[model samples]
Target chain A: MKDMIMSYSDLSSSIREPWHMLLFILLSSWTLLLCVAPPATWAESDKITIYSYSSETSINNFKLLKMEFDSYLSRFGPYELQPVKKREDFERYTKGRKDCLLLISSWHFGNIGQTYSLKPALVGLRNGKKYQKRILTGRGASANVEDAKTARIASAASDLHTKEALSEIFKGKDVADRADILTVPKDIDALMSVSLGMCQYALTTEGSLEDLKQVNPFLHRSIKVVAEGRKSLLLILAFPESSGKVRENMMKLVKIVQHMPLDPDGRKKIKMFGLDGWQPFDSSDKLTKGD
Target chain B: MKHLKLTWLFCFFLIVSSAFAANRMPKVLLINSDASVSKYGEVQEAFKEDIPHPVVGVNLGDEKWDMPSVENLLYDEYPDITYCIGSKAYHIASKYIGEKDIVFSSVLNWLRLPLTRKTYGVSNELHAEMQIMLFRYIFPDVRKVTMLYSKRYTQELFKNAKDKARNMGVEIAGEAVFKGRNTISAFDRLPADTDAFWLISDPEIISDKKGLSNILKRCEKRNLPFFSYHEAFVKLGAVLILSVDNPTIGRQAAGIAKRVLSGNKPAKNVEPPAGSHIILNMRKVKAYHLKYNENALGSVNSIVE
Candidate 1:
C-alpha cells in the first residue's frame, strides 16, 4: 500500500523505485481491497469495461462473444465486457462510450452506417440461402440432373438465387441449366416439403438445418445440411472510428480475434450470427461495398 | 502372551506380504459399464497378469446401481487404484476418486470427461468417418448411405456420422425404433439406389461382425456395398472403413495410466481420448464385389483380399 501510494502518490512522493515495485504494492492492495470490499466489487466497476454489439441475440453469438471477452480480459486487465442483449442497449453504449465495438448483421449494417458514424472494417461470410433457384433434396428422390428435369428440385425461392449459388458451386456451369431444380420461398417450408414428401428438397441455412432436429427431434431423422454452397459476408464489427481512442479496444479486439481459432464454438457462432471478424479503424475509413 | 506371539507371527506374514508381495500385489479396482468386458477384457487381463499389482474386475450395467457405493466399500476393504473402464463407470468412479489419479478406458466422448479430473480414454478417433468420407470421395457417384439402428440407443453414432457424411455430400438414410422390439422388418424394404450401408455403434443390432454379417448378406443381395464402424463387423461381413480397435484403446488407457502413475493431479490432468485406429478388411470387400480405392487398402489393418 505504501509503495503503490509512493509510485503514483501525490506529487511530492518518491520516484526512485521501479514501477514494477509499485505494481506489486498495487496488486497486494487491490487483492486486500477485493477481499475486504463488498461482493459488488466483482460486478460492473469504474475499471476497464467491454461492450459487445449483439443483433438478434442467440446462444451462438452470446457464447463466442463471451469467450472473446474472457480472452481479452486474460490478456489485458480484468475488465467487464458487458454483453448488451438488445440494440437499444447497444445504442446507449456506443453513444456515451468511445471504447465500445459494435457488431451488426448485414441487413442492419447499412442502416447503422446511414444513421450512425460506425464503420465496417470486418466482413462476415453470409452462408445462408446463397441461391434462389437451388433446392435441397432428400435421399430417396428420383430426379435427373438435366436442367429440364431440375424444376422438381423444391426450395422456398420462386426465383433462382439457389440456382445461381448452386451454379457457382459448379463454377457457373449452372447445375440447374444441366438439371431441373424447383425453388421455394422459405427454408422451413422447403424442409417440410421434403420431409412430408411434398418436394424432394429445401433451401435452408446450414445452422438452421443443423438445429432443425434440435427443435423437432424427429426432424433430424429426415433432414440434414446436404450441400454447402451459399457463402456471404453477413456480419461486420463496426465501431465509430471518428474518435482516436475508438481504436483502443477495437485494436485489442482485433488482436484477440486472430487467436480465437482454438474456440470452435466462437468460430461457429460467428458464422451462425452472420458476422465475420473485428475490424479496428479511425472514423475516416469508409464502410462501403469496396470492402 | 501366547496370543501376542501368534499375532507377531501374523505380523511377520504381513510384513512379507508388504515387502516381497509379488503374488499378493497391490490391488487395482477396474469397473466397467457392461458385463461384456470383452471390449476391454484383454487389457484388463494384461493389467492383472503384467502389472506388479493385483487387479479386481467388476461390472455394472447401464443403470443406476451402487458402483461408487461398492467402490467406497472396496477402497475401505482394500486400498486399490481404480481404472474406470467406460464412460458411465468413469462417472461413477469420479464420485470417489478424490485426490486419487484415475485412468479411463474404452470411452467415446472424451469431451464429456470432467476436464478437471485426471481422465484419459479412447476416442472414436474420426477413423470411421474419415474412411467413409474417403470412400464417398473415391466414389463420388454415391449419393446416399443407409444406417440401421435398433430402436434402442439410436443416438449411437448417427449425429457425428450424419454430419460428416452430409458435409462430404453423401446422404444418410436412417431408420430407428430398435429399443425392445426385435423387428428386423425395417430392413424388409430397402430403398433402391441406396449406395451403401454404414453400420454404427449399435450393440443391440450388431453385437459382433457375424451379427452384422447376416445384415450384410441382406444388403449384398441388394447389390449394396456395406461399411461399418466396428472392425470386427468388417471381418464378419460388412466391408468396413474401421472396426473399433481395442488395442489402440488399450494404448490410450496406458497413456492415462502413465499420467496417473506419474502423479499428475487428476482434476487438472483429464485429457481427450486418443483417436481409434481404423482397421479395414478387404475379404469382405471382395465378397461384395466392390473395388474400393487402393488408398483404403493401405489403411487396412487386416486385408483378406
Candidate 2:
C-alpha cells in the first residue's frame, strides 16, 4: 500500500487526458478494495509465526527477512514475523507454543534444544556448505593451540559458540582459565587486534575472516589462519511439536523457502542476510556428536 | 457493454505500464575541497568521463560555494550521490548530503574522519604496513628505526606498524609527542645504535621552527639515514619520501563511485590509499654512503639531484 502511494506521481504523470478519468477510477477502486475488502481465500488460514533470536538493535535485518518472507509466502497463508531480542523474551514467546517456527543459532540448538524439543526444519547455506571457527595469527607465525598459552589472544569469549570452540581446542578447559582474552565486539575487531599487534592471536570463523580479507587486502597479506575448529551451522529453522495439520503447514513453509524463486529482489534480500539459499538440515549427526 | 469493459481494461493496463516507466537517472555532484589542489581537477575530469550519468562540479572553497548555495544546488539538482575530492569537501558534503551515497578521495587522516556505511573513500596516505615495507626495501640492513609521531595523528598507524615491523624483522623506537610537553628530549634520546630516523608526517612534532632545524642538524651530525613522508624533504637531505600517486587516487575514487552508482555497496566501508611512489634524493644516498637495493632503485619514480 505504501509502495502504491509512492508510485502515484509516476502514474498521474504518464496517463494521458483521454484516459485520466478512467485511470483515476481504476486506482480509486483498487485502493478502496485493498482497504475495505479482505480476500476470503486467506482470511481463514492460520498465521505461520516465524521468530528469530536477533537483538532489538539488529531488528532492521530481521525486518528485511520478514519482508522477504511476506512477499514469497503470501500464497502459503497469513504469517507473522517476530524478532525476539532477549533469551528470556524468546523463552517466553516459545512457551507452550506448538505452531511457531524459529531461526536459531547452532550454539542455542545444542545447548537449549532438549528442554524445548525443537525439531530442525531447514538450514541456511553459504555456498552449499557450513562454516567453521578458525584461529588466526600473523603470516609465518606459530600455528599451535599451545601458542595461545603465553600469547595475548583476541576473542569474544562472552559468546557461547566462541567459548565452546575454545573449549574444543584447549582440551575442554574453560576459555577464561587459559589465556588473555580481549573481548571485542565483532570478528573483524578480533582479527584486526592480531593484525595490529594488540594481540598475538585472534579467534574468528572461516567465513568471517574471509569477508574481512575480501574487504581489506592488507589484512589478507599480513594475517593467516593458524588453526581451524569444528564446523558450526550458521542458521537453522526449527519448530516445536504441533498437530499434524500445523506441522504439515510448517513443512510446507520450509519447502517453500528452500525452493524460493530467486527473483532479483529475492536474491538481494537473501544476500543481505549473507545466505545463498536454504537447504534441508544435514547436520543432525554433528548436532548429536556435539550434544 | 463489451466495448466499455475493453476500455476499462485498457485504462488499467495503461496505469500499470506507467508505473514501470524509466526512472530518472541519478545525478552526480563532484565537490572539490581545495581549489588550489591539482588532484581535485583530475578527479573532476576522470569522474566526468568515467561516471555514466549527469554530473555537476562544485568547489567548497569558491566564494559562491557556501552552505546556502550548496543547499540550493542540492535542492535544484537533487543528486543521488556526491563525489568529494578532499577532506574539506568531504566534511561539507557529509554534513549537508543527508543520506545520499558519497565516495570521497584525497583525504588525509581518513581514519579520523567520521564516516558511515554509505560513505566510502580512498585514503590520502599509504597504509602503514606498506610504508614500513617500503622502508625495509630501501634499508634492508637497518634493523631498528627511530620514530617521532603524535598519538592524535598516527596512533592507529603506529599500532599497525609495530606488527608489520615485527614481520619485516624491524623494530621501531617510537617517541610519542603532543602539545604542551617537552618533546625535544624525546628526539635527543635516540638510541646510539638506532639505524635510521623516520620522520612521521605530523605537524605537532615539527611545528616548532627552531626544533625542526635542531633535529635536522642532529641527524646530519649523527649521519643517520633520515626517512620522510614529503618529497620536498628529500631535497633537504632526507633519504626518500613515500609519495601517494595523486592521479591514481582520482581513478580509484572513480572506480568506487562507479560501484556505488551501479547499486553495489562498497566492499570495505573504509579503504587505505592504493598507490605510492618512491621519490629519492641521489645526493643524500651519496652523502650517507648508502647502498640501495637494485629493485628499489628500479621502482623509484624520481631522483632529486
Candidate 3:
C-alpha cells in the first residue's frame, strides 16, 4: 500500500525521461490543436454562394424563397442561396467573393453595382415590364411632397434607401433627412400603415398600389399618390467581373437564372421573387441610375 | 280565398323575421387590460380594422372603473361576444360575462384559463410544436435542449413540448424548480450534451430581471445558445426569440369572433396564434459561435446586430 502511490517528486522524475517528455509535448500539442481548430462541419467549402437581397419581398418569405430557389438551383451544381436582410450585409458578403452571384434589386444594384464590378446579366420582368415606378402616397388629398416633412412615412425600403428614394422624389427639399420613416416588411404593409392611420404617408411601388387597388379597393381609395419617382429597373441577377474558374461558375449561374422560367419548379421559385420571368439585360435599355 | 291570403302573409312574416335575425351583426365589446400598454392599443386597432362590427372598448386599468362599474357596464351593453386583450381583462370578462361567447388574446399560459365551449383564444405563446420546428429549422444541429421551469406553471407545457420535440427528432430535458427557489442552480444540473437552453415563460422560474440576467450570464459562461419566448431578451443576448405578432393575434381573435357571431362553430375552440414574429440576435449567435441556418434569415422579423 505504501508503494502503490507515487509522490509528486517521483511523478515529476518519471516524466523526465526523454520519450516521456516527447510524448507529453505531443499530447499537449494535439490538445491545443483540438482546442483551436474549428469543427469539421464548419470548414470552408468550394460551393458557390448566391446572396439574395430584395426590398420588395418581405423578410418572412425569405426562408421559403431560399428553399424553393435552392431546390431548383441544386440541379445546376453546388449552389447555395443565402438571403440577406440588410442591404449593407448583402454588399459586405459579395464585396470580395468573386465565386459568388448576387440576386439584388436594381435600385440596390444601381447604388453599388459599379463599385462591386457586378455586370448585370439578366433583368427580372414582373407583369412583362422591365421597369417599375415608386410612388409616395398619402391619405385623403394630402399629396404634396412638403407634407412628408411633418408626416410619418412608411416604406418597405431600408431606412437608408428610403431616404435616398425620397430625396430623388422630393428633389431639392431637405425633407428626406427630417422625415420620420417607418420601415415595414412589405410594400403592402407600408400602404396598410397609411390606411390604418399608423402612418400618414407610404413610399411604395406603383405596382404595389395597383395590387392593393385590386385586392382591397376600400383601403386603396383612401390613399392618393403624392409623388412618383423615375422608372427604375426591377431585380437583376448580376455576376462579378472576373476571369478563370470564378467567371465560368458565375456564367453557369446566369444560364440557370435565365432558364429558370422554363421549368415548372423553376417558374414557381422565380415567382417567389415577385417576378413573372427573367429577360436578358440590354445595355441600351434606359433605366434610372439610382443615387 | 281570405284564408289562403292569411296563410301566405304568415309565411312571409316568418321568412322576414328569420332573415332579419341572420343579418343582425353581433355586438362586440373589447376589454383591454391597460390602455397605457401600446401592444394592447395595437391589438384594439387591428381588431377594429377587421371586425366588420362596431366595437365598444373599455380599459380595465382606468381609475374611473371598478369591478361593480365594469359589471354594470357589461349588464348594460350586454355584448353578444366579449373580446379580451390580456389576462386581467379575460378574468374580469369571464367572471361577469361567462354566459356569453368570449374570445381572448395576449393571455399568458392560456391553458390555465377557465375555458368553456363558448370560449376561444389566440394563445399568447407559440405552440410547442411550432417552436420546436422553428428551432430545428434555424438550428438543424441542435438536437437537445434543456429548460428550467416551475412544475406548477409549466409541467403540462413541458410534457406537451417534450412529446412534440420527440416527434421532430429532438430531445427536451426539463428540471422542475420549486416556486421562489433559486432556479440558477438548475443550470448546473443540465445534461452535458444540451445543445441549447430554452427559456420558457414561467413566472416562478424567471420571477424578475435579475434572475433572468443571471440565467443568461450562466448560459454565456457555458457557451450555450439561449432561445427565449420574448423579443426583449434578444437585446440581452438571447440567440433566438419567437413571439406572437400582437396585431395578427387581434385579427385572429376577430376571425374567431366573426365565426361565433355568424352562428358558425369554429373548427377548434382554441387555436395557436397564427402569426409568429421571430427575432435573431446576431451578436449572441456570433459570440456563441452557433451553427444557424442562413436560409432561415427570411423568417426573422428583426435582427439585433
Candidate 4:
C-alpha cells in the first residue's frame, strides 16, 4: 500500500512538470558531473625529458623528485623527464636529440674540469677554507687510491666539473695517466661500482655521505670521500642547442615553481635532493662536449 | 520479484569492491622525537597518503615520557603497532609497544625492547646482536671503554652500551653528566685512568654551551682514541666516528610495520651500528700510534690530525 501511494505521488509530480521538469533535472546533473578536476591537457606524453644525473639517492630521493618535477612540469603541455642511469646510456639516448638536458650531480665533483658552471651553492667552511660538499669512495678497496700509481677514480659523466675535480685532487701527477679512468653509465653506477668492486675510487658532491651509508653499512665502511673541491662556483642546469623549445619551457616552469606554495612534504624532497633553487641554463653553459 | 533480484546483485558487487578497498589500505603510525631531528617527513614521502591511522611526533623534547597529557595522547590513538625511530621515541613507545601487539625495526636496542620467541615462532634479535658482535670484531684489543650520559635519560641506553661493551671483554667507565649548567666539567671529572671515550651526541652533549672542544682537546692531548656517533666528532678530536643515515632507519622501521600489522610480536631484539662503516683518520690514528691495520685507513671518510 505504501508503494502504491509513492507511485501515485510520483505520477502526479511528473504530470505537473512533464518534459520541462525532466529536462531541467537532467541538465543540472550533467553540468555538475562536468565539474570534476580539470582535464589534464598535458601528461607524461607531453612531459619535458630531462637527464637526471643520479646514483644512491635514486630509489629514496629521485623517485620523489621525479614525481615533484612531473607535477611542476604539468603546466607545460604533457612531457616526460626521463632519467638515464649511466654515461653510456645517456650518450646513446641523448645523442642527436637537442631536447635532453645534462645533469651532473655534485657528488661526482672530482670532475672539476668537466664544467657545470662553477657557481657556489653551498660552502663547507673548514679551518678557514671552503670546500665543495662531495661524497667519496675507494676507502677499503683493492684499487687503493692514496699511493697506488694505477687506480681508476669515478666521477660524473665526462663533463668539465669531473675533469676539474680530478685535476685538483691528482694535482701534479697525471690522474688520467695513473688510473685506468673508466667512466660508468650513470652517477649511481659509478658510486656502486666503487662500493661493489667493479671500480676502485668514486668521488661526488659534499652532502651525500649520509645517502651512500643508508644503502649499506658495509658500503659506508668501505668508502670515504678523499678531497672536497673549492666550492666557489655553483653548479647550474645545462642543455644542448636542440633543446630550445623544451629548455625555454622548463626554465619558465622553474620560475613558476619558485613561487608555488612549498608544503612540508614537498620541502622534504627538495632538501634531500640538495637543489638550491632552479636556474635557466645559459646558451654557452648548458651544452657539454661529447664524452 | 525483478526489483528484488537487482538489489541482491547490487549488494553482491558492493561486497566484492569493498573487500578489495579495505584490504589495500595500510595502517601506519610514527614514533619520532620531534622536528629538530624528525624522520617523519621522509617516512611520509616513502608512503604518501594518510592511511586511516595517526602519525604523531611523541617525544617533542618539551614533554618527558611520564607526562600525563603526553601519555594520554599516546594511549588514545589506536595504533595497531608502533614504529619507534629515535632513541627518545623508543623510550616513550617502549611502554606503549610493550602493552600492545607491535613490531619495531630501527632501535639501537633489539634485546631490551621485548624480543620474544613467539614472534612468528623461533626468534633471533639479529640486528641488536650484530652491532655488539661488530664492535667486538672492529676493536678486538679493547679492554675498557668509558661512556657518559645523564641519569634522567634512564639507564636503558647506558646499560645496553655497558653490556655490549662488556660481552666483548671491555670494561665500561660510564660517567653521568647530571642536570647542571656545567655538564662537560662533569665529563672531565670522570676518572682520568679511563682508557677511551665513546661520545654519543645527545641532548646533554649538544645543549651544552660549554663546547666539547675542551673535552675533545683533552682527549687528543692525552692521546685517547675517541669513538663517536659521526665523524664530525672524530674531526673535533675523536679517534673515530661510526654511524648510519636517517632514511635507512625509516625503511628499516617500515619493515617492522609489516610484521606488526600481521599480528606478529612487537619489538624484535635489534643490534647497534655495524663495523662496515667505521672511520679512522690515519693522521689521528698515527698521532695516537695505536698500531691499527693499514687496511683500515684506506676506508676512512675523513682524517684530521
- CA RMSD, predictions in order: 25.7, 27.8, 19.2, 24.4
In terms of lDDT, the best-performing candidate is 3
Candidate 1 residue lDDT tens string, B251-271:
435534543554543333443
Across all models, the iRMS values in order are 19.8, 18.4, 12.0, 14.0
Models ranked on lDDT: 3, 2, 1, 4
Which model, 1 or 4, shows the larger TM-score? 4
lDDT against the true structure, each candidate: 0.51, 0.67, 0.78, 0.48
lDDT of 2 by residue, A189-277 (tens): 45554654545677766765665544445656767676666666766778887778888877777776666526544554444345666
Off by over 4 Å in 4: A1-291, B1-18, B21-136, B181-189, B263-277, B294-305
lDDT of 3 by residue, A229-263 (tens): 87889988888888987687778778888888788
lDDT of 1 by residue, A16-119 (tens): 56885687678889999989865543223223444555332221124434554565454443344566555677666667455555656543565566567766
- Misplaced by over 4 Å in model 1 are A1-291, B1-81, B85-101, B107-120, B123-131, B134-143, B150-152, B180-185, B188-190, B203-214, B230-236, B257-284
iRMS for model 4?
Answer: 14.0
Residue pairs with backbone atoms closer than 3 Å in model 3 (clashes): none
For model 1, the docking class works out as incorrect
Candidate closest to the true structure, highest TM-score: 3
